[model samples]
Target: MATDIPSPDARPARSGRRSGDSTTRTDILVAARTLFGENGFTKTSMRAIAAEAGVDVALVSYHFGNKRGLFSAVMEIPGDPVLRVTTAAAGPREDLGRRLITTFITLWENDDTGVALRAMLRSAVNDEGAATAFGDFASGAMMPAIATTTGLSTETVRAIGSCIFGLAVMRYLIRAEAFTALTTDDVIEQFGPRLQAIVDADT
Candidate 1:
């Protein structure tokens, strides 16, 4: 007679609360929030969070996928920023700047993504750790990807990122009437070509 096999869910439950438990997840989040605020995103290591939570480092990955994922959780960011920006960069070289400007403007206007983005920007402006994390994400990952796609130097791409960053700060953070009063298309029409100029600097 063939023996009956146990289904995956029917298997014996683990004895402890450490195995994918809600309490464990809460511990990690609490630890991550404290560290991320105190040390900033770039400076706070996953290992430190794991240690602080009294859990294995792998649990951090299991719970959040990676450092950025963990940061997104701690910061309540809705999605992967690198993926979003790089995806926007994908297209013909001529419109790279336009696409980027459009992307940032769209992100700013959206309710779900915009609030988290503005919060992060506010934190970055005031906190050194948050600033470094933003710089690294832009200069290290996002800028390099845009540079490769557009044949522009990372410095040039970074300049464009800075311009958009300033736009965000002015429009949202400072609530400057000049920037806030303009329609999305107005902002894009004015700034797009200026960003494109940096892209075309070498040409």
Candidate 2:
């Protein structure tokens, strides 16, 4: 048998995959943070993050659930939008809207989580990629979770999601004087019924 020989310009083939170990998680986070900082959340793809981390693309999803989840992890968002929204839906149907509004206010008013969330919203307003990513997260994950928990139609859940998203922009991001002047209770009182109407109408 002839011995195999490498060509002069050939190099050793290498696999970028890292062993699935405790450090793998940390590696992905580090990679994600670096890429996110360089390219921003909208520009950074899950595959790019995985390649940067030398891990499989599926590994990123395995740890963070999806692109938005990975972004939340990299940004150190206190709690995820999905978790917060789903938690709000855990109560009685009549109270769902109020609970949702309350949860949104509590989260957006927090020092740490609020800052990160504000950044995300501002980015979406200014960047097309970020807007697309935000829309995907809201429609793909957030609305589905709410629809499942509340037994609402997709259309109804989407309407509620849209309402909540607009709430964030007006009250926090835009700082519309009218909206910002209202106290949290005022917001819940006024907006809760709007969401309730959507849910109630879905019959």
Clashes of each: 0, 0
Q: Which stretches of candidate 1 lie over 4 Å from their true place?
A: 1-17, 34-45, 127-129
lDDT of each: 0.74, 0.75
Give the lDDT of residue 200 in candidate 2: 80
Model 2 lDDT on a 0 to 1 scale: 0.75
Residue 105, model 1: lDDT of 91
- Indicate the residue-level lDDT of 110 in model 2: 79
What TM-score against the true fold does each predicted structure earn?
0.78, 0.73
Off by over 4 Å in 2: 1-49, 56-68, 74-76
Tens digit of per-residue lDDT, candidate 2, span 43-108 = 567777777777776788899887767867765566677787888898798878888888888888
User: Could you give candidate 1's per-residue lDDT for residues 1-203 as a string of tens digits?
Assistant: 01122222222323342646668888888877766656555456677777667776678889888877777776666777767777887788788778999998998899888888889888878977567656655655567767776677767876887898889989999999999999999998999899888878855
